[model samples]
Target: PSLSLSHSLSLFLFLSLSRSVLSPPASLIVSPDRSQFFEYESVSLSCEVQGNSARWRLKRSTVFGERSDCGRNWGKPQGSSCIVSLIPSHSGVYCCESGSGEHSNAVNITVHGDRVEEEGG
Candidate 1:
């Protein structure tokens, strides 16, 4: 009887853990399809969330190791999106995160300067 009870308890715990691990996470999609851009051009990083959320924000990481907090707001009933103007300095990986502790995959962006023409005027 003692051995049977222990086995049942162990089985219950294993099943519960498996369910938690296998459950699907909240869905989020970021757009402006390609992640690359030019130095002075404007780029908007937007995301759509599917599921419950408390809040969200757009975070950017520059190639020079600087981080900037672009925008943040309460999550909408149907999800939310934000657009940020791009400058030469705003080049690198960007992503979105929910205040409820959810984060989207990182999108790498490369911003470059225009080529200079060397000639006598």
Candidate 2:
């Protein structure tokens, strides 16, 4: 299959950035390390970096809006993440931003089911 121009450009950019001297973009880390979660639980998404979090606000993309900043109404910004009170509506991709415009790679969060079983013994 032929790659669309937009897809080609995206691939090029992804490759260029991957090879660039710049550090890999920041990342969102989940405490449980599990993408799946039960409803009504607290899900914490922390950034890989510390310090200077004033520029950081959890970002989410939606079908209606390409991107939107997570508001304090849904969760409180603590340290490097927006600690959201997990609900089904919160299931989506999330990322963190810094003052320099360096945004972390997006992480997918799934909030559904009844309860999350602990991993490992």
Candidate 3:
């Protein structure tokens, strides 16, 4: 009986480790496949996983030190994709994260356009 219990415990640990090894982090897919954009342009980002894509959400960290999630403060979430309107101030790093705390690879996006400012005294 002692040996049977010990073997069962070992099998449980091995199965746990195997599950972790079998699941790879999701990947972020950017439509239009470019990192640079002009003002007024829109970008679509999606999360690619082996199973369900709905488990992930888009996230962004702007150059101004602001972080936002899709459908929360910035992009519009459409199904498994997030659509973002581009502006010069929207340049930042974007990625996908799952509710289980799994993070995908990140991409850096830069918006290039004129920033108009009035001369101040």
Candidate 4:
């Protein structure tokens, strides 16, 4: 008894699909790379997705609400990276997400200061 050619091809495709599905998505890397910061410090983050084509943006979460995109006012968007000035309000968990919803691991950031967090909206 032997396997048919179609069956072998189908098995190969299944293995490939399983590997892709099991692998993690893109990764988020921080520049000045520590998770701790003083107020007004500049923080930079970039996404590390293999073969990614500028389809991702930094997504953030804080105490006041659900997650949201790091907008232009928060920082400058250059290529696949974002540079944000750390105000206390900017203290939160940050991650990368493609517009299509693929996500990377989250990074927790803390801004040390006495000032109250202001509106990020």
Candidate 5:
């Protein structure tokens, strides 16, 4: 018995799909990478995927227990990246999520309320 051309092609496609399914999800890259940030600052969040990043979107769960996507009411989406103006309310966990339900590593961000001034005694 011999395999048909269509059968071989189907097998190849299956293997390719299997490899992608087993591969790790995309990663969320943060600019000026740090856990802490001051209020009124800006941060950049982008998705680094195996292929095109346009399939992924930046998401966040704020400290106020609100979940939302970028470019909605939070950050502005520019290409595959999101530019966010930092605020105390923006302190939360951020990550990248694909349309296929794949999620990247989440990052915790903290935005300080205000800078305290020190007085000389």
Candidate 6:
């Protein structure tokens, strides 16, 4: 019977591509989990998404290295979180992408400088 209808259409296209490659993408969370920062303290970068309505972007890299785009769109409410505020060059890696694009897994920040040293022996 046409080889069992070509093996049931190749097992329904391998179970619809294994359920769309295991289906899991769209969730971002960033907290002060040792992603160090200092200097005029005021740092908050949060992003979370599960399904629909997500837009958050903040990029920074200085201290002799250049990268721009401090903010963009940034709209996420209803349980999710999106907050941004950090100065002192806003050093190093920070990433968050959504709106169906799905990208969030790079949070390395280090903004130092709160020096205080004056003692003579």
Question: lDDT of each prediction vs. the true structure?
Answer: 0.58, 0.70, 0.84, 0.81, 0.86, 0.56
Q: Which ranges of candidate 3 are over 4 A from the true structure? A: 1-23, 114-121
Clashing pairs in 4: none
lDDT for each residue of candidate 6 in 15-105, tens digit (9 for 90 to 100): 8888646753443455555576666555556555344533654444555676554444222222444444455566677666554555656
Candidate 3 TM-score, true structure as reference: 0.72
Across 1-121, the per-residue lDDT of candidate 3 in tens digits comes to 9999999999999998897677656889999999988788999999888777777878899877998888876778888888988878879999988889888889999988843432232
Per-residue alpha-carbon lDDT of model 4 for 1-121, expressed as tens digits? Answer: 2578889999999998897688646888999989988888898888888776478778898877767776744767877788898887888899988888878889999998744454332
| RMSD, one per candidate, in order | 6.1, 9.9, 5.5, 5.7, 4.0, 11.8
Residue-wise C-alpha lDDT for candidate 2, range 14-70, written one tens digit per residue: 988885436644667777778777787787777776445566667876433557675
Query: Model 5 over residues 1-121: C-alpha lDDT tens digits?
Result: 2569889999999999898778756888899888888888899998889887777878999867899999878899887789999988899999988898889889999988765531222
What's model 6's TM-score?
Answer: 0.28
- Please identify which of the two predictions, 2 or 3, would achieve the higher lDDT against the true structure: 3
The TM-scores of all predictions, comma-separated, are 0.58, 0.61, 0.72, 0.76, 0.75, 0.28
Error of 6 at 17 (Å): 6.9
Best by TM-score: 4
> Best candidate per lDDT, number?
5
Error of 5 at 63 (Å): 2.7
Model 1, stretches more than 4 Å misplaced? Answer: 1-31, 72-79, 115-121
lDDT of 1 by residue, 1-121 (tens): 9999999999999998886456523333444566666545555555544555446666667777776556432112223555555555666777767776556667787755662422222
**What is the overall TM-score of model 2 with all chains considered together?**
0.61
lDDT of 6: 0.56
Q: How many steric overlaps does candidate 6 have?
A: 0
